[model samples]
Target: MSEPGSSVAAVVVAAGRGIRIGGGMPKQYRRVGGQAVLTRTLDALGGDPVIGRIQVVIAADAAAFFETCRAELSPAVADKLLPPVEGGATRQDSVRAGLEALAAAGAPDVVLVHDAARPFVDSELIARAVAAGRDHGAAVPGVAVADTIKLVEDRDAIGRVRETPARENLRAVQTPQAFAFGLLRAAHRAAAEEGLHAFTDDGALAEWAGHAVVVFAGDLRNRKITQPADLIEADRAFAGPSATGSGAETAKDIAMTTYVTRLGTGFDVHAFTEGDHVWLGGVKIPADRGVLAHSDGDVALHALTDALLGAIADGDIGTHFPPSDEQWRGASSDRFLAHACTLVRARGGRIDHLDITVLAEAPRIGAHREAIRARIAEICAVPLTAVSIKATTTEKLGFVGRAEGLAAQAAATVRLPEDAEADPVDAQAETAMRQG
Candidate 1:
C-alpha cells in the first residue's frame, strides 16, 4: 500500500497507428485545437503537481514526430518528461513496455496508465485516480452506462441478444487507470507468463490476476478520440458554450467596458515542389509534392500569424522573421505564430478568434481540417471553437485549379485593454513634463 501522498508517475500509451481517423500521421500525433493530442495528454498529466514523473510509450519509428510534439510542451511539464520507450504489437505489450521502462527508472509508489487520445483528462481526474490507487491496490475510472446495453451473440452475420446486463452494475471504463506500481507490474508479468495477452484494459488484466479493481467516477468530457466523427464532435464540444462558461461572458463584459476589438486579414501562397510532404497548420501531411518556402511552408500558419500581427498594428511575418534570415530558413511556422501571440499578451490583449481558408487542388483538407483547427487553437492558446479552418478549390480555373500552388487567407479578431492603447513613450514624456 502506498503511504499518504506517495510519489505518483504516469505511463501514456500512444503507439497506435490511428488509421481509423484516416490521416497520414498517427492520431495521437494529430493536432486538436492547435496541439498534438499526445501533447495535451502529457500537459494534463504533467501539470498535475501530484504526478512526479511521466514516461511515454510510442512507436519506435515515431521518434522524430515525438520530438516535434515535445518541443511544444510547457517548460515545467517538459522537465518531468522521461525518455520515451518503444511499444509492441498490442496494447498489453505496450503497457508492459511502459511498465518495464518505469521499473528501470525506479518505479513510483503509484502509476496511472492513460490513453494518449484522451486529451481532455483534467488534473482533478488525475488526482482522483491517484487517491483511489493509494486506497485500493488498483482502480479504474468509469461512468454509469447511459444507454441500455445488450449482450449479443453473432453467428454467420446474424445477431441474437443473449441477455441484458444490469445497467447499474455495468460501467463504461476509461483511463488513467491507477494502480500500485508493483502490483500492476507483477500482474502484467503474470499475464505474460500465462499467455493471457488479450485483455483490452488493465483493469481486466488485474481482475484476471485475482486483484479486485475498483471503479471510480469518470468525466464524460474525457472521451477518447477514435474515429473522424469523434474529432468533429470534440471540436464542437470544446467550442460549445458549456466549455467557455462564465469566462467567455466575463471577457465579453470586459470588452464592452475597457477593451477595443480589432480585426485583420492576411493571405499567403506557396507553389508545389518535388517532395513527399507539405506542412500546413503545423501538421506534416503526406503529399505528392511539398511547397516552396523559406520556412516550413505552412501557408495556414503563416497567414494566421500575419493576421495576428496585423490586428496588433505590428509588422507582418516578413518584418518579424524575414526570409533573408538564415536561422529561420527551416523554422516551424508555429514559432512565428507563438511570437505574435506573445506580443499580443504583452500589450494586455487576447486573440478572440481566428478564421482561415485554404485553397488546394490536392491532398484533401477534409481529412486534416480538424487537426489544423486544433493546432491553431493550441498555438493561439485559445479555445478550439475560437479557431476555424476551411478548404476549397478554384475548380481547375487558375494556378490552384491547375494544381500548381496553394493559397491561404486568414482573419484575426483581437481585444486589447484600454490601457494598451497608450503609447509608453508619450506617457513617460507627459510624466516628465509634469514633474519638471
Candidate 2:
C-alpha cells in the first residue's frame, strides 16, 4: 500500500508477549470469541473513521503468527492493515521502529500510538484525539484519578510509607496517545541522539522533549486487557445481561445509557369569531363565544395527545386523527388524548409527565387552570400533579389577539423498558452462542 501522512497512520504496539496470562502464544494473538485479540484491536482502530492506515509491530518471529491471524480479520479491515514489521526488544524500541516505518512510508500530519491490548476505544475519543493533534500538535486520552495516592520511599528495611500525594494533582494515563508527525519524530530523534530510553510512554516522551501534552476526558470503556479476567469483563460489557446492570456502570459507560423521550403540542382558537362560550382543557368555559372549529375543538386535548404520542415515538394526532374524520368532524377530542396514552402503554412505555400551554386573549384561563388540570388528568389516566394545563396570551398577537383561533402547545416525557425475556428465542441464542 502507498504510504500516507503521519496524521492518517497508527502504530499499534503488539510486540508484548504477556507472560502473566500464561497463554502459550503471545497475548496479542490470544483468541477471544474465536478471533485473535490483536485482530479485535485492529478492528476497532480500522473502524474509526478518522484513521486511514495502520502499521502493527510484533516480535520478529511473530510475523508468521500474524499471517495465520490475518485469516480471522473481516474482509473490510484486512486490506487496511500493512504487513507486520519487526519490533525492537523494548516497548519504546518497538514504537521507534514503527515510527521509522511511518516516516519512510510518507508520514501523515500525526500518528496515533496505541497498545494493542485495549479494544473498546470509541469513535468520540478517536475524533477528540485526532482533533487535538490537528489543533495542538500532541494529545493523549486520559482520565483523572478519583482515589487518594501516596508516594513511598525505601523498600527492604523499614519499607516506610511516606507522604500522601495530593489527590487533586493526579491523573491516570491511558493509551492511543496521539502526536503530530513532526513533534513525535523530533522527540524520538532527540531521545535517540541523547542515548535516552527512560520514558515510560510516548506522551511522557513529549513532556521530556519540552512539549506540553494536552489531556482530554477518556471513556472508561477503553480498558487494557492485561489478564484473562479483563477479557471476560469486556465480553460481558459488550454482549451480556448488562441491561439490568448497576447504575455505577451506567455512569461510567454512556453507551449503556437509556433515555426516556416525550413530546406534547396544543392548538386553541376562540370561536368568539361569532358565538357564545369557549372550550378550554376539555371543559366548556362560560364565555361570549365557544372555541371556533369543526368540532368542540379542545386545543388542550389536541396538545396533550400530540405530547403523549411524541413521548412514545408514535405519530401525532394529525396523522392518526385527521380533521377529515367526519365522525370526529364534530366529535369530542378528550377521547383522542385517552387513546394516545393507551398507545404509549401498549408499547411498554409510560407517560411520566405532561404540560400544556394555551394562548387565548379571553375566557380567563388563569382561574380555570386547576379545574382543567384535574379533568384532563382523569381523562388522560395520569395524576393531576403529573399533568399541568396552563394558559397565556401572546399579549394580543396574530390570530390569537384577533380571536381568529386559539393555539396551545404541550410537552411530555415517557420512559420505556424493553421486554427482554427468558423465552425460547433468547434461550436458543444464548445456548447456541455458549456452545460455540
Candidate 3:
C-alpha cells in the first residue's frame, strides 16, 4: 500500500461509556462472540504486519476491566500494546489524548484512529486506510448509502421530512479514519486551542480544520456495536450455526468433520509455609500461611494449567516452566495458565469448560469462589458460566486435613481439530509422565 514498511500506529478510542448497549459494564468491555469487543479490535489491528504499535484510550475507572480484557489476547498481539492512557469527558478529548500519547512516543509515518466497538475491521481495510492516507493526507472509509435519504425537522412529536437528499450522493462513513501523523496532530492541537471539540470523528475534525478528507470504500460487515441488537448480531456471527437457527448446518454436517471433544485431569499440592497470603486460581487470598513452591505457589492455577495441557496431550505446567529454571522462581502462575491457553488455541482448539476443586481445611474457598471463577475465566478467555470451583477437606486424614498443605484437582474439557499434530516437546514430557 504505502511502500512495504511505512511505520503505522493506531489509536483505539474505547473511553466511551457505551450505555446504549445496556450491559452493566461498558459495551467495549462486554463479551461478544466469547471475546470482549475491545480485545477483538486490538487483535485485528495488532495482527496486521504493517502496524507497528497501538495506543488505547480508556476511562479512568476501566483499568481493571481493561487488564482482564488484555489478558485474553494472544502474547504476540498483547506485545504491541502501549500503556493505556486515561480519556477525557468527550470523544474528541479522548482521541486527542491518544494522538498526543502517540506523538510523544515519537510519531509514525501514518496514524489510524479506530473505534473499539468496530471489531470486524480487517487487515485489508487497514491497508487501504494507510494507502489512502499517504496519498490524500486524510481519508475515511465510507460505504455508499442504499436507502433513500431525508432531512427532518423536529417541530412536533414525530419529526417531519423537510428535504430529501439524492441517494447517489449519500455515503455512510466508518472508521480507522487515516491521516498523515503530522497533519492530524496539528489539526487536533489547533482545535484544542480554539475550543473546537464538538466534532464526532477525526475525519470531521480534519474537515473542519480545512483539510479535504477523501472517502475510500468501507465494508458493510464492519458494523459498530452501538446498540444491544448490534451486539447480538455480531455475537451470533462468531458463535456459529447454533446461534443463528435450527436449520443451519451443525459441525458434524459440515465437511472436514474431524473436530472432537476431549477431557483431561490434573492434581497439584503445596505444603504450607510462613506467609500471610496464598495465590489460588490467579486470585490472592488472605491465609494463615502460604504454599511452598518455586512459583507464586498457586495450586489451583497450576492444576488447571496442567489440565489444559493434558486436554491437548501437551506437557504439564512443570514440563513447560520447570522449577529448576531460575527465571520461573517466584513468578506468577497466571502466566503459566495463560501460556497453556495459548497452546490450546495454537492447535485450533477451544476450551469448553474448566472445573477445579480445592482441598484445604483453612482459608475456605467459599467466600472467594466467584472471584476465583472470574479470574480463571479471564485467563482462559472463556465465559464465567464455563468455569466451576468447589472446595473440600480430608477430614483430618492427611496433610490437607492437618492444615499442613493445600491441594487442588482440576478437569478441563476442550474441542480440537483431529488433524492437529502433537507438540514434539510436550510429547516427550507426556511419554515421560506415562512411564513414571
Top of the candidates by TM-score: 3
Candidate 1 structure quality by residue, lDDT tens digits, 1-436: 2357578889999888887897546788765443467876787778778888999999976775676567667899899989999998899999999999999998899999999899888877887898899899899999999899987887546688999999999999999899999999999999999987777799999999999999999988788999998765554443343432111222223222256899988999999999999988888899999989999999999999999999888889999999998999989999898888777755657677899999999878888888887777667656577888889999899999999999999999987766666668888999999999
Using all chains and alpha carbons, the TM-scores for the candidates as numbered come to 0.59, 0.53, 0.73
| Model 3 error, position 137 (Å) | 3.5
What is the per-residue lDDT of model 2 for residues 229-303, given as tens digits with 9 covering 90 to 100?
876565445333332211123424423223345444444343445667777778888877665576777877887
Q: Rate the local accuracy (lDDT) of all candidates.
A: 0.83, 0.71, 0.84
What lDDT tens digits, residue by residue, belong to model 3 across residues 23-94? 445889776555678987898888887888999999986775677667777788899899999999889999
Q: For candidate 1, list the clashing residue pairs, or say none.
A: 32-374, 33-374, 33-378, 34-374, 34-375, 34-378
Global lDDT of model 2 = 0.71
> Which portions of model 1 show Cα errors greater than 4 Å?
1-5, 155-157, 237-436
19 in model 2: Cα distance from truth in Å?
A: 1.0
What is the C-alpha local distance difference test score of candidate 3? Answer: 0.84
Candidate 3: worst-modelled 10 consecutive residues by lDDT: 241-250
Candidate order by TM-score, decreasing, is 3, 1, 2
